[model samples]
Target: MSFRVGNAFSDPRVTMRQPQPVVLIRGTLNPAHVSAFYATAFPELASWLNLNRIPVSGPPVTLSHIASSTMMEVAAAYPVTVKVPTTQRITMGTLPGGPVASLIVQGSHEYLADGYDHLRAWLGENGYGPGPVSWASYIRLPDEHGDQRACVTELSWPIA
Candidate 1:
């Protein structure tokens, strides 16, 4: 399916989101291993959810805890209607609710850095500082052929 790009990034906004229950897998990964990491994590998460008969509530999200040139500490998560007991590598937790600076970007995942940069600038200009965690909800992912031109990601940073 094809998705159209939107102009949502033109005006970044701060909105309140309710705390959400999610099932996730956390890992420390090199930049080069990010794709492979998610490729494995998502399916495993899905399988566990499916086996447990849990319901998914929204798109997949990546919670970024720490990022640097060499590595990133992140969690790949899926919102769920109900929290489940932790199993093996999968953990259940709630995404914190609060004022979040958000922007939607359309294009490759490579553009996400630019989107974050934009949000950082906007936060500085608007008297806001980033909170402890940031996340990206993947609205529309790349197709099987791995073309990312049409990917849509909502970039969000909790504000302090």
Candidate 2:
């Protein structure tokens, strides 16, 4: 399918879009803390975790849910063709119409963090403020495959 790059929301959040099924969990998480998060949060649930890393930009999530403090909301995502949950049989890549901002970059996660910092500062300047932390995920960009520099991910911040 041809994913068109949108300049703006042409018709609000109702535009025809491809949304994927995902799972989500909340609470403080990072690469070091993810193992504990998984163990404590959803032990009995099925899993489809891709390349593992602590998130410095987007919100910590899985294939189906966005676990926030008070609400558990579903999101939009593209398909992940990896075998994860046999029953679910799908993964997520990105969530279009992210409601705030998105930045796609090809670099290390640290570089991505730099970009995120810049975006955060820019948002402050533009009065966007802080929104829900969301992410457009991808398969292993940087992982045990020795391609630590090619991790490409889209960082999205749904601002308030």
Candidate 3:
């Protein structure tokens, strides 16, 4: 699928954020299965939250803990207004708040690698080292919108 990258990004900036509460389900799966994982995980998370009467504070987000060619450890999460009890599968946690190099990318999932490459290059050029975690907040999802190619994601990489 064809999607625009740099042109859609807001200028990358370093911003300080406060730790936000979240509920998530994490898994280690093959790289090719990540999309399918999100598809299942997000709906389950939403249903769990609704059942618990917890309000979602922001858009659905995915946290990348470890990534490699074969497999990756990732979490599908929703920002919650308050901390909630954890379930057998879902856990309550926080999106660590700190200095992050952040940018907005509008495109299809196929173009995400290119967007991340640009972010990494920018971090290198700007003399910043990326921290352990990185994440993408799905502002507008392809399935939710009329056009499957139209999506907006906010990418954040913690910087040291």
Candidate 4:
């Protein structure tokens, strides 16, 4: 319910009016309690949205999934590399661009929500009240280190 008196575009750090695409990655966290961690995130994120003005909702633990969005790249889309050419003639790269909000969190999944809290707070205080943009998860493709405990992911939401 809090709307800022002016536009948030005054800052270069905040990008407004752009297009983006969706991406997903399998995630594994330390202590293996990502479920419980995300569960605690929603309620706080909800309040942060209102306190700002973006009017975002859900991301409820019910979905059982989450992602971060980055600028769309059709050629780079779909991490599942297709070595064989498709005979079925289909659109290959139709990526889009737009405004987006993003956040980075380090450590365990339990702390993901905290970083989100910080993001929402910064948005509310800055300007960019909740806007329309699919929440695209673009976490780094797992590293070869074979250490699931050190996995890291970036959470992004596209906007315009």
Better of 2 and 4 by lDDT: 2
Per-model TM-score versus the true fold: 0.86, 0.45, 0.88, 0.38
- The candidate that achieves the highest lDDT relative to the unseen native structure: 1
Global lDDT of each model? 0.85, 0.43, 0.84, 0.36
* Candidate 3 residue lDDT tens string, 1-160: 2333436566678899988888999989997888899889999999988998999989999998666768899999999887689879999878888888888787666656766777888899999988878899989887744574668998999887
Q: Model 1: per-residue lDDT, tens digit, 42-150? A: 8999898899888889999998866677988888999988768897799987778989998888878887887888888899999999987888999999999999988
In model 1, state the lDDT of residue 76.
90
* Candidate 3 global Cα RMSD: 3.3
**Cα lDDT over the full model 1:** 0.85
Question: Which runs of model 4 end up more than 4 angstroms from their true locations?
Answer: 1-13, 16-18, 21-96, 133-138, 141-149, 158-160
- Superposed by TM-score, candidate 2 places the C-alpha of residue 149 at a distance from the truth, in angstroms, of 2.2
Task: Name the 10 consecutive residues with the lowest summed lDDT in model 2.
Answer: 6-15
Q: In candidate 4, what are the lDDT values of residues 1-160, reduced to their tens digit?
A: 1212332111213445333221222223433454454444434444443454442221221112223242221111232122322223211221235565655444345545554555556667777654432232324323586443443434444433
Error of 4 at 58 (Å): 25
Between prediction 2 and prediction 3, the one with superior TM-score is 3
Clashes of 1: 0
Clashing residue pairs found in predicted model 2: 22-63, 22-64, 22-65, 23-63, 23-64, 23-65, 24-65, 31-54, 131-159
lDDT of 1 at 99: 92
